[model samples]
Target chain A: MAFLTADDIALLNEPQLAHVATIEADGTPHVTPVWVDTDGEHVIFNTAKGRVKHRNLERNPVVAISVSDRANDYRTLWIKGTVEMTTEGADEHIDRMAKKYLDKDTYPFRKPGEERVIVKVTPTQRLSQG
Target chain B: MAFLTADDIALLNEPQLAHVATIEADGTPHVTPVWVDTDGEHVIFNTAKGRVKHRNLERNPVVAISVSDRANDYRTLWIKGTVEMTTEGADEHIDRMAKKYLDKDTYPFRKPGEERVIVKVTPTQRLSQG
Candidate 1:
């Protein structure tokens, strides 16, 4: 199984923001900041099913995610991975991520009538800088 | 012409970091944080030729760039566009970006024997959140 190193996992464990990239149906790429998590072996983020990223990944699971330490400009990790799993606990996942990132107990921006989807990625390659 | 709003131009004009996403030759997406700049109308960054991203853009110019407000996660701009220009002057461009991001007049990470490539993007679609 793909795994982050002890040091790298520690880096990712912080509340730093992450950017997830996915390809559009027409081949254009789309990027957005995400609240990231890990299940020991896979990276994770939560979004709605019909969002651009979810739609893109449904058609093509390949992705590259970059996590940055905002306090230190030179520190970062890049994960080139595929969506090995799309699970259904986005509501709870977003809450967990919200606690980590926003210090809030619940995801602050969740809207009414919105559905949630969880994306889990398995890294095929990784890179780092500091 | 595609353009940013007054509020967004101010957000992006800050020294915050950006993540650029490009499509691979095989359809996989690649992403990395970059020191970003603007020509008031175009987005710019300096990279080296033959790098995975440069090669990818050469093969497929479409790209997605996301700039975040490090101090505030909710403020950002997403620019989806093609590489409108690949120009020279990367040395100077990198130095300029270094000033903005690192507070140094010259880029400190320059390596010997490496060529610099300047890539400029014209946003065809833009999105923002605050």
Candidate 2:
């Protein structure tokens, strides 16, 4: 039975850092923590173009995301989504999205050798249980 | 084309904390970082009885676990498995399992209000991509 309701989706729309899981060509899962912003309709996050996550998404876009309260047993939101990548000057967009998860003024805006990419995910499924 | 072979599993079996994903009643996924020992044949971890993760398992046994190198783009391991809970003086077993993930000399051994449960998961599927 489906457990998530529209209200639950709204509840999860807030800004937060979520753990993103990606499937590798070998069927093994690759996971990493990322800063994200939910627009109620989609998930947005950013990373470098040469990263494993970027490579995995290009190979296959299926992914699962989990967002939980840092403290134990408070609340959690899980999102099953597809990867959407853009190539035109995406670094600026990615940097902006990343800043939301950090202290704006002090966050490392970018590192010299690091190239960034912007990714938007449209969730195909969502699960939340508290 | 499996990304992980027996050797990779063996490499991951060494004591480590993995992020475990559980399905919540609301269909939202709950994820928590946990101390785990991979037995090659099975994955074992522990948690308190009334915890959300424990409760989630009682409702549904399906789970996915992700183990990754803290450093960027190194390696990742994913295990899809079912839950196995044991009730007998499981606290002792849990304490022992948890200790393996920590420095024995200074780990928090026990707390009065806490109740521990032992969980054994035999992975049905694994995915690793770096």
Candidate 3:
């Protein structure tokens, strides 16, 4: 698998929203807007286990995410990757993302019966534009 | 396939950037930012035949697109659909979309030795949020 460059990490660090697409078992697609993060390599997002995106990822790890610069829509990053999902520390991960995205100390949208999972995607290819 | 509502058309009519994801023959995803349009039912975008996105759509039409309101990032629309690609009138369609997104009289990005295609996506399901 390929890896993201420093420039790609810079784009991911921005406050722009990212859209992720996961293919279904039947080859259809399920896409959603997500708060995206990265550790300068792996792109990450957290979602509940019951969410459709989580279910799709469980069946097929292949995923793609695209995000444009909030200030300049022409500057964008597109990542093609496979995911590794883990439940450990998912709550903490969401809290960190909430702080980055919503200025909240904790994720305020948690449901009573939901279980969060953190998906870490290792890039196989990255398309970065200015 | 499902039909888009008037509200959905309104969203597509806005001058927001849209990202489309198409699954490659090997199931890896290819995502790109596009200028989007609609005829109150089908979402549309134009791409050159040599573009990676157009190649992916040719073999597997199942695609997902997400676009957020440029003015307010929270408002978004995610559409899952199958595409109908045609070359007829594609040049004109690109001019229209260029005018909307770039305020250009014609598509300023067309290249030599390229053939443009118009992709009309009929939504199978849509996820809209404000």
Winner by DockQ: 1
Q: Write the per-residue lDDT of candidate 2 for residues A1-117, one digit (tens) a residue.
A: 434456545545544446777755554445666767655577767777777789878988766777654433235667677778886656666655545545363336566887677
The docking quality of candidate 2, as DockQ, is: 0.13
| lDDT (10s digit) by residue, model 3, range A30-98 | 677888899877998888886778878888888888877877877778877899999999999999999
TM-score of each: 0.93, 0.54, 0.92
Q: Sort the predicted structures by TM-score, highest score first.
A: 1, 3, 2
Candidate 3's TM-score: 0.92
True contacts kept of 3: 0.48
lDDT of 2: 0.64
**In terms of TM-score, which candidate is stronger, 1 or 2?**
1
Which candidate should be chosen as best, given TM-score against the real structure? 1
- For model 2 chain A, the run of ten residues with the poorest summed lDDT: A67-76
Clash totals for all models, in order?
0, 8, 0
Q: Give me the displacement of residue A127 in model 2, in angstroms.
A: 14
- Write down the worst ten-residue block by lDDT for model 1 chain B: B121-130
Model 1 TM-score (B-chain only): 0.90
Q: Per-residue CA lDDT of candidate 1, range A25-121, in tens?
A: 8888889998888766778888876788888889999889998888986678898888954556779888998899888999888888888888888
